[model samples]
Target: MSEKWDKESILSLSGAFQTCRILLTAAELDLFTILSDGPKSVEDIARDKSWDERGLRIVMDALAATGFLQKSAEGSYSADETMLKLMAKNGSQSILPLVLHRNRMWESWSKLTEIVKTGSNPNPLGMASRTSEEVQDFIDAMHVVGSVMANRIVESLDLAPFKRMLDVGGASGTYIMAFLRKAPHMKATLFDFPRVVEMGRNRLTQHGFIDRVEIVAGDYTKDELPSGHDLVLLSAIIHSNSRDVNRMLYGKIFRSLDPGGTVLIRDYVLDESRTNPPDGAIFAVNMLCATSAGDSYTLKEIREDLETSGFVSVNLIRNGANMDQLISAEKPR
Candidate 1:
């Protein structure tokens, strides 16, 4: 069901990218952090940062116009206290990493028109193709987004029966750390690409779980999984693969699990019509812009794929309005 739309609303929707683009520009420049240090004239900022004065001034003014910054009486610009706290690099509540990742995503989305015409993302960009620094930014961004939801999702499950956990594609080990914190006696194995595993090892060491986690580095799509785990987690991972790849992955996961072990997949599981909770429908476009055949999967599609890999008792275990929907299945005993 579509919301009733008006001409004004339609026009408003068409130009929504203006504010987004302006915000992305400001965030990319680390303007929020600089302004938080102290308000400065555009000349001071541009000269210090070696940026184009004209371009910097225009974006700063646009940020003020968007109510994300304030212009002082002395002709200096600064972020509002609240906005600074959220966007500044060193602020107590900073979400800057996530913003940076979105800037990278903006680059990908810019090719949407060409992708639609070619049926492929001609100049695709993703974590698999990023520099070392950019890879850290992407991992940190995912942690910032998942830190709260991870605990909530873990709290919903009764994990007492599962002693070992395998967190597949676990970026930064955020969910694995959450699981360990919840079940102190449970040891985990985190699997991801080599670069991510190195960072994960560092974080787990800092959090004092380095001894409890066995970190494995390999690509899940074309590699064998480590076996004998009783619980597995695939959080926010499946949407990045085509169905055939997902099936191949599920089969690998199935073979890796202990008998009667449970596998939980947390993602934007769609309704039968493949469009509900609205955001999932829209996120399918994001996948299209990044992957050749990746997409948001309806529960029927997910269940069928899992079943084809020999999973049983598959069902939607949780549902939400955003990307927190979850599905669970078991390797029959």
Candidate 2:
């Protein structure tokens, strides 16, 4: 390592959660959206948002120091242009929903110690019993993320040879839209939960893809996947499942494919060390806090499970910026 690693670095790592909490709190308070109009003094913002002036000022200054906001000589703070575009609620490229979803995960993360001790999440209803609004937020957050990443993922693959695709657990049809936009001849079946399939219907219609895509509703864990597709996409799904669950899913995908069909998985495919992609390592902890047996996996584990499911010719397609790597395997003819 060229850079010096020391105690200060460890201290900084320990304090990193403070910055995360600050950003999450700011998103929850809609601070960036509030600042979208223009600069605002502490008193003005606190009064408008009905927050304590002193505390709001402190947080605003913290955000300014973090380069998310700019502090003016007039002692007012404003969101930076990037922040306005990406973090504001109504901005064209807004990721506010994703930030808000993280805010929802705050409570689960707080129980990390307990989860580690018990080998299970204490909150049984954390994901299962989410309120409708919470579910919408979660799904919308996935849409925001998927919309941004889908194009890159599509471009990374060669879809010309494939005619039909099944996007297992496809939420809101983000990847399906990307694929259809890239390959006009390709048709997709988006399979997700019933409620999520409803959202996908609206989104696909809005994207002018309702005619090209078939929306199916089912739980991949307990349901049979729709068959006869030449291609199957397991986008962002495996990380939330246990090894056995994933093995079972791979089998379902294998059976669902046409002869010599391909199954593509987009997830955090960690390297052998399980640390090359650092975000996947940290996200494993998120899984620990949120699910009973979810964790990031190494490529070896993935290949083994897929091969055991009777798939062959497994290979990596691309590695993503945030551990969203693409791995492809084939159901032998």
Q: Judging by TM-score against the true structure, name the best candidate.
A: 1
Q: Give the per-residue Cα lDDT of candidate 1 at 140.
A: 89
Which residues of candidate 2, in runs, are more than 4 Å off? 1-4, 39-49, 65-67, 70-77, 124-127, 319-321
Candidate 1 C-alpha lDDT tens digits along 1-333: 767899999999999999999998888888989988788999999899899998888988888888988988887998778988899999888899999989988888888898889897875555677899899988989989999999998898888999999999998899999999999889999999998999999999999998999999999878999997999999999999989999999999999999999999999988888878689988999998877788999999999999999999999988897788889999999
lDDT tens per residue, model 2, 161-240: 99999999898899999999999999999999888899899989987999999889999888999997999999888888
Q: What lDDT score goes with residue 196 in model 2? A: 81
Model 2 vs truth, CA RMSD:
2.5
lDDT of 2 at 235: 89
TM-scores of all candidate predictions against the true structure: 0.97, 0.89
Taking every candidate in turn, the Cα RMSD to the unseen true structure, in Å, is 1.3, 2.5
The best candidate by lDDT is: 1
State candidate 2's TM-score: 0.89
Q: Please report, as a residue range, the 10-residue window in candidate 2 with the lowest summed lDDT.
A: 120-129
